[model samples]
Target: MIEPPRFFSAADASIAVSHLFVRPDMLITLGFYKRKPGLSREQFSQHWREVRGPLIASNPILSKYLTRYVQHHCVPSNGWPNVGDLEYDGFSESWFDSLEARKEMHALPYFQSEMIADEHRFLDMKATRILMFDNQVVQVGRDYSAEIAAGKA
Candidate 1:
């Protein structure tokens, strides 16, 4: 049996809101991936949270184009009924205005060199996958479908 209470750790608090001003132009990108071979989850998450995330944010290329950037540090989703192993170790979520702006960042030498080099340290690029899309938020809160059905909106 899984003992979640014994091992569970929580993330720090965060706040988020969606504004219509950014809705039309903002593009959201998700990079799903696994850690490099031989690295522990602690090692991966520390380097990513402490080193890699800061590195990306500090760069002029990314900083200018990116409005928000977030890293997801995966924890074992044990204790959920019928759950299987997680497919990837963690993922990155980034928000920017346009693909053209993103492409401009990608074209920079700093991105091609420094950023890619840093990612090599802890990410398994071969196993990485990307998803790019815009949000069409029906809701962004705890599920309240039952309440909504009863006209709580």
Candidate 2:
């Protein structure tokens, strides 16, 4: 079994409960980004979290299709194994009802012209990678298992 992380703040635990269940057909993508050469990590993270996040959320076309969005900023870890030397500055996750919804969202002219253009402001486009997945929530707090199993999660 995969052990849960040893530490979580009260706020984090609450958020964890909200995501205890996963939609098997949900289209989820993890977008890893490298900071632009001249930008510091803080600068890149701020722009993504403050500017880009609000921009995407405010866009009518883009917001309608998104089910969930999260930004994960990377922090240095001590004593961690390093293999390839490749490191991502941060990652953003976006979810949709299906893969087709993602395709349709991108097919919009505004997404191609505005969204892609905005990304270039802080991301090293050449170093970015996007991985898609169907999410599965394997475990949650012990008290919530019955609720989740009852389809109320």
Candidate 3:
């Protein structure tokens, strides 16, 4: 009898996401003019262009902190690439002395002002799911075949 080496499952690589709201400005800027039918690639590109800068700017301080504390967040990349059904949502986090820090961010006028639903309107998407990620690993490969072969992923 032969035994096969145990490998981690795909779930092991998955991360949790929470409260993902598309920024309103991103909707129009993304040229996602239609609220019905199907989502288009043109719309996706526009959304990224409009939303990325503000999203990055809002967390400059947090980005620095996350780079220091989190391994995955520290990777230097202007944008993330997609693989099949999976999308790399990028990485970021905040370091706080207490929950008060979080509350302060939420209570900020700017944070409160942006509406996620309005942004998702173009896609006609009424619902969004948030997942929470605990443990995660970074995997990279020129091709899918290499990634499957290396358990390191």
RMSD per model, one decimal: 11.8, 8.6, 15.1
| lDDT (0 to 1) per candidate | 0.73, 0.75, 0.35
TM-scores for every candidate against the unseen true structure: 0.74, 0.74, 0.35
Per-residue lDDT for 1-153 in model 2, tens only? 222223333333222334355666777777878999999988988999898898888887787788888899887665577634339898888888887788889999988998899899999999997776565454554656567778776
Candidates in descending lDDT order = 2, 1, 3
- For model 3, residues 1-153, the per-residue Cα lDDT tens digits are 112122334464343423222221111000112222364545543553456335545666444322222212122244655524223222224333333344455565555555343345433343322222222323343434344446444
Flag clash pairs in model 3.
16-131, 16-132, 16-133, 17-131, 30-46
Candidate 1: pairs in clash: none
lDDT of 1 by residue, 5-54 (tens): 21112232122443223355567677887999999999989999988988
| C-alpha lDDT of candidate 2 relative to the true structure | 0.75
